[model samples]
Target: MNVYFLSGLGADKRVFSQLTLDDQFIIHHIEWIKPLKKELLSHYAGRLVAQIDTTQAFQLVGLSFGGIIASELSNIVHPEQIVIISSTPTGVPISKFYRGLVKFLLLSPFAAPLLKSTNSLTYKFFGADTPELKTLLKDILHDTDSKFLKWALIRMSSWERKTRAENLYHIHGSADRLISIKLVKPDVVIEGGGHLMVYAQAKQISAILNKKLKSEEY
Candidate 1:
């Protein structure tokens, strides 16, 4: 069976470097493609669909922003199951204060710069704590295309989906700062785990993946 994985915003497959899945499943990491100017996320997902080998049984594992992309892909590829980590298909939550603040920032000339910046403040805020995690985050951010980053922000803010996915499973971090558990009801929660727990808490995540995905016959 083929199991495809997608990384978070401005990230790559390295996000899953620590993950260990069942040997019966072949893992393929879907790399991000450059977005067409002003492209809608659903349309972008359509383009991404071409990369999947959909002739056989497959599953999807997406983290953070990639979770949104995975949800969009489900409308087209119909995976066996899709797992979400630290992401909500419904939409990302923004506090009233941040909403008001972003409304103003969106109009400012520095909005793009803010999105492109990979500074310590932003990394810390995103919960990349350990030196290794911080280094990976910095590298991923540096490698990310500026245009794609800007477009992803727009997609995140404007994403809209109603009704839950029947085959979708969610695994969240109790300590996730980027997406709080208080706002989401996940199928599983990793206590003391942060947004970047995919690396920090890889053992627990692997245990869940192996258990949840192992029994399905391909």
Candidate 2:
């Protein structure tokens, strides 16, 4: 099976480097394109899906912001499986803080530049504890395209889509700072995991994926 992988907000494929997928699955990293002026989430996802080879049997694996995109993409073309890490499906209960942020703030039009400074506050927020992980986060942030980041951030903040796909499988963290676990009843939960658990708890996540996704015949 071929699995298309999407990264987090302002992040790239490096975030999934640690995942150990089943031998039968091949990984294809999806890239973010520049958002059209005031484009809707579904419209942007339609553009993104052009990169996928819809003719083949495939799955989708997305983390954080990427998960949001995956959810929308699922509507365009049905995938065999959609495994989302550290993310919530659209219409699921979102935290009060997030709701407030979205309701009060104007998103999409805002632009977030690639950050050069890897501040301690940023590390604490993302749960990057070790030096290597911090370096990894820093590099990802540095490479992120500002315009696309801003566009995604805004769209995420104001998202209102509420639909579920049958093949969607969500994996969340108990200690995730951004999205509260109380708000979501995920298929699998990583105890003491944080927003960055995709990298921090890759081993455990990989195990769960193998069991839930890979163990079965698609």
Candidate 3:
């Protein structure tokens, strides 16, 4: 069997570097494509769908925003299993305060810079306190396009998945700052884990996948 990994926003395959999978499965890393200047979610999902190889059966594992994309992709082609890590099935409900904050940021170009300056704080919130991890995260963020970042954020805030897929299985961190664990009921919850749980708890994820794949074969 083949496993397709969809990395989180502002992240690449390197985000899953700690993962160790069994030899029974072939791993394929899907890279994010630049969305059009102003593209609809359906259009973006369609483009992502085009990247998959429909000729072969495969399972999908997606993290954060990538999980949302994976859900959209699953609508196009049924995967043996669809796993969502540190992600929620529903779009985050934006409160009035958050809406105002988003508008404020949009009105002030300097807002992005201000937010960038707080990277260390963000790192702490995500439990990435180690110097090496912080440096790696900074490098990842540096490579990310601001426009894409804003677009993805807006998309996620406004997006909703109406379809409750039976194949879907969620694995979340109890302390995820980005997505609230209270808002979601995952198949598995890792205590003390944060937004970047996939990186922090890769071996556990690998083991879960291996077990799931084995059970499916029987």
Give the runs in model 2 whose Cα sits over 4 Å from its true position.
92-117
Give lDDT per model, in order.
0.83, 0.82, 0.78
Residue 2's C-alpha lDDT in candidate 3?
A: 78
Please list the residue runs of candidate 3 whose C-alpha ends up more than 4 Å from where it truly belongs after superposition.
Answer: 103-107, 114-118, 215-218
Model 3 — which ten-residue stretch has the worst lDDT?
111-120
Candidate 3 or 2, higher TM-score: 3
lDDT of 2 by residue, 1-218 (tens): 78899999878888988889889777899998888999999999999988899998888988998888899998898889898988888755557688667534434343243233578877877888899789998998888777676667667777777776668999999888778888777888899998888888889988887776672567
lDDT of 3 by residue, 11-68 (tens): 8998889888788888888878888977766678788776678798888888998898
Off by over 4 Å in 1: 93-109, 215-218
lDDT of 1: 0.83
Best-to-worst order by TM-score is 1, 3, 2
Query: Once model 2 is optimally superposed onto the true structure by TM-score, how far is the C-alpha of residue 82 displaced, in angstroms?
Result: 0.7
- Give the alpha carbon lDDT tens digit for every residue of 117-192 in model 1: 6677777667888888888887877888766776787667767687557689999988888787887889888998
